[model samples]
Each structure stands twice: as C-alpha cells, then as structure tokens.
Target chain A: GQQVMQIPQYQHVQEGEDFTTYCNSSTTLSNIQWYKQRPGGHPVFLIQLVKSGEVKKQKRLTFQFGEAKKNSSLHITATQTTDVGTYFCAGGLQAGTALIFGKGTTLSVSS
Target chain B: DTAVSQTPKYLVTQMGNDKSIKCEQNLGHDTMYWYKQDSKKFLKIMFSYNNKELIINETVPNRFSPKSPDKAHLNLHINSLELGDSAVYFCASSHRQSYQETQYFGPGTRLLVL
Candidate 1:
C-alpha cells in the first residue's frame, strides 16, 4: 500500500504573503498530481508532474517534484483571499492504479 | 457541459438507511473512482472501476458497494449507514491510459447520517 503525508495540516497567512505545502510518500510514485478544493466545492485538478526534478508554474503557483519522485511541493507566491482552500497531493503508484492522497493542507488567507 | 456530474448534491438520512449516489462522466475516461472526504477534507480512495471492471478496492467497509454499469457511469450504494458515514463523497474519472493523467471530479455529494 502507498501512503502520502503532507506537512502543515493547516496554514494561516496574511494577504500578499507566501505559502508552501510539502508532500512525502512512503513509496516511490510514478507521478504526482496536485488538486485544490474550494470551500464547499470539489477537488479540481491543478497540475501533474511525471518526470523527476520537474518544475511547473501556473501564474503565482509553482509545483516541483523531487528528484527521487517520492516528494513534491506546491508554493504559492503572494497569496490572496481567493487562495483560501485545501491543497492535496495525490501519488500515482503505477499504470491503472488509483491515486493515494495526502491529508492535504488547508490554507486560510486574511485580508 | 459538465465533464463529470453527480446526482443528489446533498443527502440526509437516518442511520441504517440505504442510499445510492449516481455519477456520470462525459469525458469518455475509462477509469472512475469514488473518494470520501472527511470533515477535515482528507480525501481517500474508496474504489475504482476501469472500463466497467473493478480494479482498485481500498480497505472500505463491506456496507459500501460500487457498480459501473457502463464506461461513463459509476454508482455507489451504501447499506445500513452509520453516523460515522457523514462526509462528502466525490466521484472522479481519469483516462487511465497512463498513471500521470489528470482526474476530473464531480461537485461531490454531502451525506449526513443521523
């Protein structure tokens, strides 16, 4: 069985501050996907990293995959009120296998 | 059009009652999954169906059953639900051609068992 753990289960930041969440897996993953769930909403696909040491950026959000493929990170630069949500990191073990999700990091931004 | 859609956005039932939630994905993905999000927003995979065949079955309770009548639809039926079953159930779908593919999720069904 694969297990994913996320750090800083909860985070409270002032508007315009930065935030980051780290995810680690007990087993090496083939790929890792990040999702964001707004309050009272479903989890929306954010990004997916397949290659080792891959880094991708979307607007103010940056995603990085560790070289070992066992860890990942999501960093948000200059967070805003709209950034309030729970960010989850899900690890893919193999082809056709289901994703094992981390507990997720809930972000609260105060303006 | 919604890529993935679920029925009964909210469900409230008494303990020991049985209820079903329906999910459909027009994305034409081959793999569908059921995930439970607890009060803390921790998402856990409950089951997965690939091409209408059961593929991933997590350590879910026997009272919960999932069925995929077709590639585009997956339904979850919970029997004799308990108070602990109060959580949000999400249905998601992925291509499954590769493990790295993105998954599309429905709005989610909030179930409250009293």
Candidate 2:
C-alpha cells in the first residue's frame, strides 16, 4: 500500500513568521500535487511537480520536490492570516490512477 | 459558472436510511472521482470513473455504489447508512490528455448520519 505522511500535523505561527510542512513517502512518486483547504471548505488545487529536484515559487510560498521524488516541502516565507489552512500533498499511484494524499499539515497564523 | 458542482451541499438523516449525492462537471473531463474526508481530515478515494467506466474501487463497503450516466455526471448512492457514513464527500475531475493530471474539485457535500 502506498501511503503519504506529513510532518507537524499542527502548526501555529505569528503573522510575520515563517512556516513549513514536509511530506515523505515510502515509494517513489510519479508526480506530486499540493492542495490547500480552508476552514469548513473543500480542498483547492495549488500546484503540481513532476521533475525531480524541482522547486517552484508562488508569491510568498515555495514548493520543492526531492531528488528522489519521494519527499516534498512547502515553505511560507512570511505567513499571513490569509494563509491559514491545511496543506496536503498527494502522489499518484501510477499513470491514470487515483492519488493518495497525506495526513495534511494545518497552519494557523495569528496576528 | 462553477466547473464542478454537487447537489445537497448539506445532508442530515437518520441511520438505516438511503441517500444519494449527485455530481456534475462542466469542464468536459474524461475522468471523475469520489472522495471521502473523515474526521481526521484524511482524504481517501472511494471510486474513480474513466469515461463512464469504473476504474478504481477502494475497500469501500458494497453498500456504497457509484453510477456514471455520462462523462459529465457521476452520482453516489449509499444504502442503509450508518454512523460511520457521516463525513464530507467531494467530487473531482481531471483531463486525461497528459501525465500531469491536475484535478479540479467541487464544494463538498457534508453528510451527517445519526
């Protein structure tokens, strides 16, 4: 069975501080996608990474895929209240297969 | 217009009753999926439909059935629901054109079984 796990299931940070969540897997992933879910809301797609050692930045957020494609990390440069939500990392089992999502890392930014 | 939509945004019913959640996507994607998010916030895939054909069926109970009348619509029916059936169910769709399949999700339908 392919399972994805995330570190720091819960995290709280000041508005100006930084935050990060790491994801690890036991098997190599063909591709990885990150999603964010607001409180009492559905999951929203953020970005996807396919190449190994890939790093992408979107405004204050940075996403990195490990060289082995079995681990990933999401870093928030400067956290804001708007960034408060749970971050999930999902990996596809194979081509044309369902994705397995991680337990998710909940981020709470307090002013 | 929303790309993906589901009916009955909220449902509360008694145990042993049957209920169904309907979903439709306007993106014209060839693949659709049904997922369950438990209290722990773990998203699990229960079913996947590729071009109206059942492709993936996890260890979901047989009481749960999914029907896809066409590529634009897929519905889920639960029979004799139990307490464990109370959770938020989400419908998602993705195009099969490439390997990087980015899924578009709809606002989930919350089900509460008492």
Candidate 3:
C-alpha cells in the first residue's frame, strides 16, 4: 500500500515568522496536490505539482516537489493570522488510482 | 452557486443506528468520491464512482455502502454505526476519473456516534 507522510504534525508561529511542512511518500508519485483547510472549513485545493523537481509559488507560499517525486514541501513566509489552518498533501499514484492524503500539518499563527 | 453540496451538515446518533449522507455536485463532474477525516485530521478515501459506476472501493467496513444514483449524486449509507464511526465525512468530485484531476470538496457532514 502507498502511504503519504507529513512532518511537524502541528506548528505554531508568530505573525511575522515563517513555517514549513514536509511530505514524504513511500513510493514515487505521479502528482502531488496541496490543500488548505481553515478552522471549521472544508479542504480547498491550493496547487498541484506533476513534474519532477517542480516548484510553484502562490504569493507568500512556495511548494516544491523532489527530484525523485517521492517528497514535497510547502513553505510560508511571514505568516499571518489568516494562515492558521491545516495543510494537507495528497499523492496520486496512477491515472485511475485514488489520492492518498497525508495526516496534515496544523498551522497556528498568533499575532 | 455551490459546486458540491452535502445534506445534513451535522449528525449525532446513538450506537447501532443507521444513517445516510447525501451529496450532490452541480459542477457536471463525471467522478465523485467519499473521504473520511478522523479526529487526528487524517483523511482517507472510502469510495469513488465514475459515471454512476463504482471505480474505487477502499477497505472500508461492510457497514458502509455508497450509492451513486446518477453522475451528479453520490450518497453514503452507514448501518449499525459504532463509536468509531464518529468523523467528518466529505464528498468530493472531479471533472474526470483521473487521479490527477483537481477535486472540489463539500463542507462535510460531521457525524457523532455515541
């Protein structure tokens, strides 16, 4: 069975600090998707990386896929109060397979 | 308009009860799925359907069943629920059956089994 593991199960940072969460998969992934779920909210798709060694950015957030496609990371710079939420990384194995989601890293930012 | 909608935002029932959660997607997606998020926030896929056909069925308990009446609807029925059944159930849909497709998730149904 394929598994997606995320690090730093929980994180708390000051408003101006930075945060990063890492994800590792037991097997190579065809694609990796990142999602954010606010408190009492549904998970929302943020970005997806399919290429090896791919890097994508959305404002202050940066996402990277490892060259081997077995790991990924999400980094947030100068976190804000609105950044408080749980970040999940889901890995896709193949075309017809389902996405395996990581346990997620809960981020808490205090102003 | 809501792309994916689920009925009964919250549910609380005693043990050994039977309950159903309905999900509808107006995004015209050809695929629908059900995911359960436990108290630890671990999200796991339960079932997936494509065009009213079951495509993926995880190793879920026999007490859980999924019904897709049409391409636009997928519902989950749980029978003889137990305390371990308490979790947030989310319904999501993608434009296609491909695993790489982006998924739009509903707000989720919070079920509590006492």
Candidate 4:
C-alpha cells in the first residue's frame, strides 16, 4: 500500500516568521497535490506538482518536488494570521486511483 | 454557484442508526470521491466513482455503502453507525479519473454518533 507522510503534525509561529512542512511518500507518486483547510472549513486545493525536481511559487508560498518524486515541501515566508490552517499533501499513484493523503500539518500563526 | 455540494452539513445520530450523506457536483466531472477525516485529521479515501461506475473501493467496512445514482451524484449510506464513526466526511470531484487532475472538495458533512 502506498502512504504519504507529513512532518510537524502541528506548528505554531508568530506573524512575520517563516514556516515549512515536509511530505514524503512510501512509493514514487505520479503527482502530488497540496491543500489547505481553515478552521471549520473544507479542504481547498492549492497547487499540484507532477514533474520531478519541480519548484512552483505562489506569492509568499513556495512548493518543491523531490527529484525522486517521493517527497515534497511547502514553505511560507513572513506568515500572517490569515495563514493559519492545516496543510495537507496528497499523492497519487496512477490514473483512476484514489489519492493517499498524509496526516496534515496544522499551522497556527499568532500576531 | 457551488462546484460541489453536500446535503446536511452536520448530522448527529445515536449508535445503531442509519444515515445517508448526499453529494452532487456541477463541474461536469466524471470522477467523484468520498473521504473521511478523523479526529486526528487523517484523511482517507473510502470510495470513488467514474461516470456512474464504481472505480476505487478501499478496505472500508461493508456497513459503509456508496451509491452513484448518476455521473453527477454520489451518495454514502452508513448502517449501524458506531461511536467511532464520528468524523468529517468530504465529497470531491475531479475533471477526470486521472491522477494528475486537481480535485474540488465540497463543504464536509460532520457526523457524530452518540
């Protein structure tokens, strides 16, 4: 069975600080997707990485995919109170397969 | 308009009762999925349907049955619900059944079994 693992099950940071969450998969993934869930809200899709060693940025957030396609990372610069939420990483094995989501990293930012 | 929607944003029932959660997608996606998020926030996929056909069925209990009435609707029925069944259930849809596709999730249905 394929499994996706995320580190820092919980992270608390102050405003203007940086935060990062790492994800690793037990098996090589065809693609990886990132999601964010705010308090009492549903998960929202943020970005996806399919190519190896790929790096994508969205404003102050940066996403990186490992060369082996088995790991990924999300980094946020100068975190704000609006950035408080749980970040999840989901890995897909192949076409038509359900994604395996890692235990999300919950981020809490205090001003 | 909501891309994906589910009925009964919250459900509270006693153990041994039966309940159903309904999901509909207006994104014209061929694939729909149901995932459960436990208290620990571990998200696990329970079932998936593509074009009204069952595609992925995980190792979930038989008491948990998923019905796909049409390509745009997927419903989940739980029988003899237990206390352990308390969790947030989410419905999501993707443009296709491919792994590379991004999924759009609906506001989850929170179920609590007493």
Candidate 5:
C-alpha cells in the first residue's frame, strides 16, 4: 500500500509571514497533485508535478517536487487571509490508479 | 453549469436507516470516483467507475454499494448506516487521457447518523 504523509499538521501564521508544508510518500510516485480546501468547501485542484526536481510557481505560491519523486513541498509568500485553508498533497502510484492523499496541512492566517 | 453536481447536500438520519447519494458529471470524463472525508478531513477513496463499469473498490464495507447508471452518473447506497458512517462524501470525475489526472470535485454531501 502507498501512503503520503505531510508535516506540520497545523500551522498558524500572521499575515505577511511565510508558510510551507512538506509531503513525503512511502513509495515513488509517477506524479503528484496539490489541492486546497477552504472552510466548509470542497477540495479544489491547484497544480500537478510530474518531473523530478521540478518547480512551479503560481503567483505567491511555489511548488517543488523532489528528485526521487517521493516528496513535495508547497510554499506561500506573504500569506493573506485568503490563504487560510487545508493543503493536500496526493501521490499517484501508477497510471490510472487512485491517488493517495496525505493527512493535509491546515493553514491558519491571522491579521 | 456545474462540472460535477451532487444531490442532497446535507443528510441527517438515525442509525440503521438506508440512504443514497447521487452524483453526476458533465465533463464527459471516463472515470468517476467516490471519496469519504472524516472529521479530520482525511480523504480516502472508496470506489471508482470507468465508462459505467466498476474499476476500483478500496476495501469498503459491504453495506456500502456504488452503482453507475451511465458514464455520467454514479450513485452510492448505504444500508444499515452506523454512527461511524457519519462523514462528508465527495464525488469526483477525471479524464483518463493523460498521466496527470486532474480531478474535478463536486460539493460534498454531509451525512450524519444519530
């Protein structure tokens, strides 16, 4: 069985500060996807990484995939109230298989 | 139009009762999935369907059964629901065309068994 684990299960940061969440998988993944769930809302897809040592940026957010394809990270710069939500990293074991999601890192930002 | 839609957004019923949640996707995707999110928000896959065919069943309880009327509709029926069955269930759809499968999720149905 494949498993994905995330660090800092809970994070509380003030506005203008930075935040980062790390994800590791028990087995090598073919691809990884990131999702965000706002309070009382469904999970929304954000980005996906396939190549090893790949880095993608979306405005104030940055995503990185490990060289081994077993780990990933999400970093947010100058967090805002809109950034409060749970970030999940899902690892794809093989083609056409269900993704294994991590416990997720819940981000809380206070002004 | 909503890409993925679900019926009965909120359900409150007593234990031992039977209930069903319905899901439909308009994206014309080949694959649809059912996932459960517990109080801790840990998402786990329960079942998957491809082109109206059951493709994956992830050790879910026998009381829970999923049916696909067509490629666009997938429904879940729960019998003899227990207190532990209370959770938010989400239905998602994805195209099986490429390696990076981007899943489109619908607003989850919250079920509470008393």
Candidate 6:
C-alpha cells in the first residue's frame, strides 16, 4: 500500500509568521503535487514536482522534493489570513495510476 | 465558469437509501476521478475514468458505482449507503499521462448519512 503522510496536522500562526509542512511517502513517488483547499471550497492546484531533488517556488511559497523522491516540503513565508487553508500533497506512483493524497496540514493564521 | 463542478454541494440521506452524485468537467480533459475525503481530511481516490472507460477502481465497495457517460462527465452512485459512507466526495480531472499532469478538483459534495 502506498501511503503519504504529512506532519503538523494542524498549525496556527500569527500574520507575518512563516509556516512549513512536510510530506513523507512510504514508497518512492513518480511525482508529487501540492494543492490548497480553502474552507468550503475545492482543492486548487499549486505546483507539481517530477524530478528528484526538485524545488519550485511561487511568490512566497517554496516547495522541495527529496533526493529519494519520497519526501517533500512546502514552506510559506510571511503567512497571512488569506493563507488559512488545508495544504495537501498528492503522490503519483506509476503510469496510469491515480494520485494518492495525504491527510493535509490545516493552517490557521490569525491577524 | 468552473473547470470542474458537482451538483448538490450538500446531501443528507438516511441509511440504506440510495443516492447519486453527478460530476462534470469543462476543461476538455480525457481523465476524470472520484475521491473521498474523510473526517480527518484524508483524501483517497476511489475511481478513475479515461476516455469514458473505467480505468482505476480502488478498494471501494461494489455498492459504490461510477458512471462515465462521456469524457467530460463522471457520475457516482452509492447503493444502500451506510453511516460510514458519510464523507466529502470530490471530482477531479487531469491528463491521461498519470504523471507530470495536474489534477483540477471540483467543489466537493458533503454527504451525511444517518
């Protein structure tokens, strides 16, 4: 069974603080994607990393893929209230296979 | 204007009853998927349809069936639903490559079975 687990199931931070979430897989991943789901909303695609040891950034958000391709991390700088949401990491194992998602880290930012 | 959409954003039903959740995508993608999110917020893929053909069927119960009338539509029907079946169901679409492709999710349907 392919299991993707994330740490810090819940996090609360003040505005202007930084936040980080880590994702570890029981097995190697072919690729991994990051998604953000706002309260009462659908999950939106953020980014995807395919090659090992890959890192991608979008504005204040940074994503890193481990050399083994079995771990990942998402770091957000200067978090704001708008960043309050659940962040999920989904891993794709093989060709034609569906993505397996982790339990996500719920971020709550207070102003 | 939604890339993916599901009808009846919220559903409440009694145990043993049957219900259906309809999903549609306008992104012109060839692959569609159904995912279940539990109370703990863990998302699991239950089914996938490629080109309107059943491709991946996870360990989901046989009582839960998915219907793909076309490439852009994938409907999920649960028969004799139980209390444990209560969860948020999401519909997503992506390219058929299975990797390097991003999945777009719809506003999930929150099902409450009593």
Identify the candidate with maximal lDDT.
3
True contacts kept of each: 0.88, 0.68, 0.88, 0.95, 0.59, 0.88
Ranking by DockQ: 3, 4, 6, 1, 2, 5
Q: Higher DockQ: candidate 1 or 4? A: 4
Question: Please, what are the lDDT tens digits per residue for candidate 2 over residues A1-111?
Answer: 879889999999999999999999999988899999999988999999989999999999999999999999999988999999999999875775678889999999999
What pairs collide in candidate 5? none
Ranking by TM-score: 3, 4, 5, 2, 1, 6
Kindly indicate the candidate among 3 and 4 with the higher lDDT: 3
Using Cα atoms, each model's DockQ against the true complex is 0.78, 0.66, 0.89, 0.88, 0.66, 0.79
lDDT tens digits, residues B60-105, model 4? 9999999998999999999999999999999999999888888999
Compute the DockQ of candidate 5.
0.66
lDDT of 6 at A31: 91
Tell me the tens digit of each residue's lDDT in model 1 across B1-114. 999999999999999999999999999899999999999888988998889999889999999999999999999999999999999999999887456778899999999999
What is model 2's interface RMSD? 2.2
Considering the two chains of model 6, state its CAPRI-style docking category: medium
Off by over 4 Å in 5: B97-99
Best by DockQ: 3
Error of 6 at A95 (Å): 0.8
Candidate 3: where is the Cα deviation over 4 Å? none
lDDT of 5 at A74: 100
Residue B64 of model 1, lDDT score? 98
Between candidates 4 and 6, which one is better according to TM-score? 4
Interface RMSD of each: 1.4, 2.2, 0.7, 1.0, 1.8, 1.3
lDDT of each: 0.93, 0.92, 0.96, 0.95, 0.94, 0.93
lDDT of 4 by residue, A1-111 (tens): 778999999999999999999999878998899999998999999999999999999999999999999999999999999999999999999865788899999999999
TM-score of chain A of each: 0.97, 0.97, 0.98, 0.98, 0.97, 0.97
Question: Candidate 5 - CAPRI tier?
Answer: medium
